[model samples]
Target: MKFFARIVAVLGGALIFFVGLGTAVFKSGLLGLVICLAAGAFVWWVFAQEREEYRGNIEALNRETGLNFKEAFGSGTTSMCIDETARKLALLEQGGAKHRLFGFEEIDDWELRWTEVSRNGSLSFQNVHFTFRTTQLEMPIFKVGVNSKLNGETWSQKLRLLMA
Candidate 1:
């Protein structure tokens, strides 16, 4: 759903951009040029804002967790990190609106999980993630958002070794 929304947004922006460009080229005078420039500036501004927000969220998460993440992955609204020195894992979701932090010892079991999506009899799998099960809770972590069974298996093995 998020991906679809993003695609739609990109298409809309492209349409506006081309329309502005076409108008300027077809002798619509300064109005077309101004529209084109404005469209470009608006797009740039939106991207810059999103980047700033993402960076701020990451910095905030680091400060709140007080852990130096050695490795991080994913983008958009979710991020996964490993604080190897601290022997902890972190999952930041919803563009850092929510997060989870847990130690290796706290994980009782873990598995790579796949979510199946079906629409109009068409089947697809996505949002592959590692499911970490603790005595107190179970949650998905490291969402890669793809059908990566091999990748998941590899990570699962690595996690098993780490937990052991």
Candidate 2:
């Protein structure tokens, strides 16, 4: 899915660039070319930033837990499941039975951090980070969109209640 999105972005950017170039040559002047260049630059910047973030995330995970996060959470499509009966949270990735389980008893603390970016009085982006305790590593469970903030807060509350 992410790969497909990247492909779409590249193709869309290229299309915009070509259209702008054609317009500049046939009808419009330098204005068309400038708009096209801006569109292409934006696409390239977005992809570059995303790549840097992935690299940083993997490096941090490796430094803290010695786990290769890129291999563990391939394509970042991890399915999260909470078992109330067992008091555990499980992460399933890559259609494999292999998973990482976090018992409520093992958690010492948890926090959900949220950030929002606004541009011209309009919300541009909102993100949430879930950080919690592990036996040996204090790693964040996930960083997701603002829509997941409520769920993350609920999960953290449940874990705290279980601990108490």
Candidate 3:
């Protein structure tokens, strides 16, 4: 649903932009075209900045964990499996070639953080951070997302229960 909303937003923005361009071209000729072009360039630049920020976040996570994003989240090529009965959590990468596993006993601590983002004095969205510890690395394992607070808390509780 979130993905669909994003797609709709992008399409709507493009439609509005083209409509504005058409109106400008019909009115001011070459000058309008130049203005429309400038607007398009500005929009492109904004999207580029957003993409860079997302990429930087992934790079930072990779650097801290010494694992590629694909290896960590599987990126649709793998699956994350948790076995509470066995007290194990595993990240199964594509082709089953490289996998990571951690026993519950190895965890030192864990935390779930919820961050709220607002715009124009109104609530916008929420970000959830799930961080856990393991003796294999100096830094903790972290997973962050823009998911519902209820779902985040539920997952956090389940994981904590398993760890306990």
The whole-model lDDT of each prediction reads 0.67, 0.58, 0.56
Estimated TM-score per prediction?
0.56, 0.43, 0.44
TM-score (C-alpha, index-matched) for candidate 2: 0.43
**On residues 99-160, what C-alpha lDDT tens digit does candidate 3 reach at each position?**
56667777777666666788888975455555666776743563434255666577667666
Please list the residue runs of candidate 1 whose C-alpha ends up more than 4 Å from where it truly belongs after superposition: 1-11, 17-52, 74-76, 115-125, 137-147
| Candidate 1 lDDT over residue span 21-85, tens digit each | 88888879576777778777766766676667667776787788787764355535666667777
- Tens-digit per-residue lDDT, 1-164, candidate 2: 56577778888888888888888989896977896987789688868966665556445544554443332212233434455555665554432233565666666665677776888898643456555556646454443222455665675676567567
Winner by lDDT between candidate 2 and candidate 1: 1
Global Cα lDDT for candidate 2: 0.58
Clashes of each: 0, 0, 0
What candidate 2 gets wrong by more than 4 Å, as runs, is 1-76, 95-98, 123-125, 137-146, 158-164
Choose 2 or 3, whichever is better by TM-score: 3
Best by TM-score: 1
Cα RMSD to native, each candidate?
Answer: 6.0, 10.4, 10.9
Candidate 3: lDDT of 106?
A: 74
* Model 3 poorest ten-residue lDDT run: 70-79
- TM-score ranking, best first: 1, 3, 2
